[model samples]
Target: MNWMEDGMTSIPNVLLQNYKRLQIEEKEMMVLLHIYSFTQKGISFPSFEDLAERMTISSSDCAACVKKMIQKQVVAIEQGDQTGYEFYSLKPLWNKIAALFESDARGQSLQQAMTAEKDLYSLFEEEFGRPLSAIECETLALWIDQDEHDPSVIKAALREAVMSMKLNFRYIDRILFEWKKQGIKTVDQAREQGRKFRKPTGTEQVTRSENAVPFYNWLEQ
Candidate 1:
């Protein structure tokens, strides 16, 4: 065999990537990896003395690390075919790493949603030129949590209201309701609908008089 082939040992990428999430110290991880290497070389249950020989730690410390792993359920002992034999299994470790990664992904998604909700509230307050009342806040929450409206779509509706010179909650609410009725779920869809809604009728120019606001009547639609 080539020298490179003789010396090469491969471990799962997830083991390395998510080892920190395992909540184990670095030394424990080193010990775990060394055990994994031993298993790859066909040694399922290397003696603690043998492990200590490969590392700078004492045999008792190696045993202690293995014990901790066993307590954490990341490693287990299984009986060998021979009555007096046993070995370490790393199955739980891989399972734990995968679960941690999955949980982290969910946590990140939920955090992004929460941040977007806060931003939506702040945007509304800024546009309305005052802090929102409790009922207004609840209405926004209902649109997101109950009606399942996307924050971006709601923000687009707010912009549409501003452009139409109808910067009020009732008009914005009507706009959202109309968009939902039309099955518009995205900001792009809402924009397209807005363009069509504002298309010039015959030779009439789209403009507002001093006492009249030119706006799409979403309430009637």
Candidate 2:
């Protein structure tokens, strides 16, 4: 309808892929798009009123939208060099979108990892002879999700607890804690550590499956 520049303004492809998924409203998108347009046309840091007037939105609404965009990590503010003007940087938005794709492409691996986690959960329940408590489940989830512990390492810790007649989550957690202190994060590494220590295997290999009240010594240590 109107003739201004012959070329199109360049928006990052990452933004195009993930704007809606980030819960950005149309007004917010328009705000970012307008800022991008201003940047491309060499117009710097137009006031909120400038944006509101152009978009026919209220000034407060424009400000709120920009704030929401910033909260959602889709916009950033940068101080202009000695111009007393600020710019909205879109780099974080682009980076977040790129991370989303990187995560998506690993969907297959994530599913496989989930399967391994299910197997680990089942192994614990079977060995314990009861469904895990809510607190226990949350603890295991934290070990997997927050601590990023390997399933094999967890299994080894569980096996160690079983062999030591501990048969409790706390003791298993302690074993993991001790292993982490030694940087033993894998079954192979743990096994190698065991060989390096070469302690007496006869006393620690008893496979106690009987239900018993767990001791707090491990936690104390």
Candidate 3:
């Protein structure tokens, strides 16, 4: 029976129909859906291992499917000696597929998009109280776009690190490294550590005055 007879009028079906016109399998439909979902979310395209995990299939199977899609010209795969594989949709074909499923007028206005990005930058400056370095700014932008990590958790860690270490970026880096080594990615871990360090012990009470010297002076002594 024809796919239309089966009443499956989804984007994937449209994509499959396009591929079949070029003599490809309907199974490519599933792989295209997976790729569309991944890219639509603005995440870094998944690695082969990631695709395997998400699809609950073996890596070899995932690789085979990818190769077939590439061969069929429904997907494009780029490989770099250093950077590994990147997958991009054949945009013309995908657009046609999407148009079949729904109207294509769902894009954002340029002004609204720019305003949102500007707001994020403003928030970043307020949180850090200084302009982000280029690399830091790029990292935050990627995080915001992908929604991969929690901004609150990152902000709390930054705040605790700054407060505890007197805003020394080097010390903050060290603290972040240690937390990462311990698999502490959330804010609560940093807060708990800060609380522990701030607790007044008898030794701390007795030696507080003596240890109040500047870090450089203490180092010199």
Candidate 4:
């Protein structure tokens, strides 16, 4: 038999990554690994003396650590039906670890969403070429938080305002309102509406001032 194979124990990556989150201290975690190793070698209920021999802790201290694990509901001792013998069970510990991973993923997702929403103000400041006023900032927040407007749609409205050379909060607000009224929920829908609105009628001439770009009169709409 290989010397490496005889000594190896398989520990989960999540156990190492999130042991602190589980409130397990360094010494306590070592005890858990020892317990897992013992279980793997067919020693389910290893005595505290056995655990203490492998670790720096005293047998009494090892017993205390086992008590703590029991209180935390991570490990339990159950009686075997055939032999009437007690052994350690790690089912609860694995369940807790799984729940922690799911909770962390949800927290990260929510944090990312909040970061995107917070960046909306900076985007407006960059386009307007100046810092927004307190009132102007409040209005922008209302559009997202209160009115439930999509950030992409708000950005689309900003682009429309820039093209029209209006460059003001009122014009941008008007564009948003018109899009809402027209049931435009996406950038594609907004672009289609813009094309239709700007299309010239048969009676109108194609000529335009050399200094001006063609844009829809959103205020008139």
Candidate 5:
């Protein structure tokens, strides 16, 4: 039996469908799909230990599986100086594989749509100084794929958050939501607001709140 038939026999039909569309090795595919599940729920990428626990395998075996996946172009791996392995999806390859199983007319359109969205995300990252988190990247990708949001405005906000505020993903998201509530959608407007927020307020007080005391500062019982 072929890989597809084997997959159908061994794995659930819903999972098998996702696996086929990604064209990844069975072990790697299973782990990747599980990781993808966490992403769908707004969690960032899973760690090596997390992957090992989920797969019910040793860390070494999980490492090997991940390495093989990196080789297969199903996932991209980044090793940090102090931090460890970071995995990201190889969306282009997955999109191509997905297109192959779709109707010919729809396949071409879907392929084009995926490619365009990827290009737009590349532009977003380029405009921003640093890489986005997995959740942020996936959110942008989904929005672009659906063509429901303005890429230019989103890119501008991302750039403003990265450049003006010393903001991470959480802070950036907060600023984005605040801007949205205030009906500030354009890049220029975001940049202007960022500039205003960044200016030092001479009279601003650094008052400590009631919860500001450290754990060690609390009196012993």
Candidate 6:
């Protein structure tokens, strides 16, 4: 059944959330609802005559209401198409909705960013085997964000330090400095470079390794 036959149409409540404050009169509101109904039914070119014929409004009144809607920027019309008016812009509606919700959207985005930063802090603590000091946290952030180093590369450097039994920030810094000198900017490159610098595995090799000395052992020496 045609919607016009039953005089039934549904309007989205959100579109009319500010309907009472729209600065349009009662008859104009009725015309706007008619436009909504026609648009929902896929009738791009709605007939003002048919609308006026069904309602108590005259065709002239309905036309005047459409002009008012266009002036208010609530509706738009394109002139060139043979369909009389082919384009109807809902930009005004979009502007209103964005104004209503932009703050909430930004708040959500800020919260997500803060959560991610905290997560990175926790990850660094776990990897470093202790709570990060303020300066240490800043250095980690600098590597990831300012220096544009990948977090995985930083983690690989951390793991490299741990494996060498020199789990110190200064040791990690040395690894980063060496990789930077070797043009390594990613975990894959770091791994390949690690392989290039790896020593032979044996008791004799361990005895010959410079990395066999811990940080505290060097201080005591």
Q: How far is candidate 4 from the true structure (C-alpha RMSD, Å)?
A: 5.4
Best of the two (3, 5) by lDDT? 5
lDDT at position 24, candidate 1: 78
- Give the clash count for each candidate: 0, 0, 0, 0, 0, 0
Q: What is the lDDT of residue 19 in candidate 2?
A: 83
Clashes of 5: 0
Span of ten consecutive residues with least summed lDDT in model 5: 212-221
For candidate 4, which ten residues in a row score worst on lDDT? 212-221
Worst 10 residues of 2 by lDDT: 212-221
Ranking by TM-score: 1, 4, 6, 2, 3, 5
Identify the runs in model 2 with alpha carbons over 4 angstroms from their true place. Answer: 1-7, 81-84, 112-221
Residues 31-121 of candidate 6: C-alpha lDDT, one tens digit per residue: 8777777766677568789679768989998999889888977777766456465745556755765665776799998798667667767
lDDT of 5 by residue, 32-143 (tens): 7666665555554677787788777776777787677767666675454687745455464455555665666687887886676677678656755567779878777654
Ranking by lDDT: 1, 4, 2, 6, 5, 3
Better of 1 and 5 by TM-score: 1
Report the lDDT tens digits of candidate 3 across residue range 47-164.
6676676776777877787788777555776554687856565664675456644542434444565565676567657766888898777765665456434455445545655456
In Å, residue 125's CA in model 4 sits off its true spot by: 2.7
lDDT of all predictions? 0.86, 0.81, 0.60, 0.85, 0.60, 0.73
What lDDT, from 0 to 1, does candidate 3 have?
A: 0.60
- The whole-model C-alpha lDDT of candidate 6 against the native structure comes to 0.73
Candidate 4, residue 13: Cα displacement in angstroms equals 2.2
Question: 1 or 5: which has the higher lDDT?
Answer: 1
Error of 2 at 52 (Å): 1.9
TM-score of each: 0.76, 0.47, 0.33, 0.67, 0.33, 0.49
Off by over 4 Å in 5: 1-15, 18-23, 78-87, 102-221
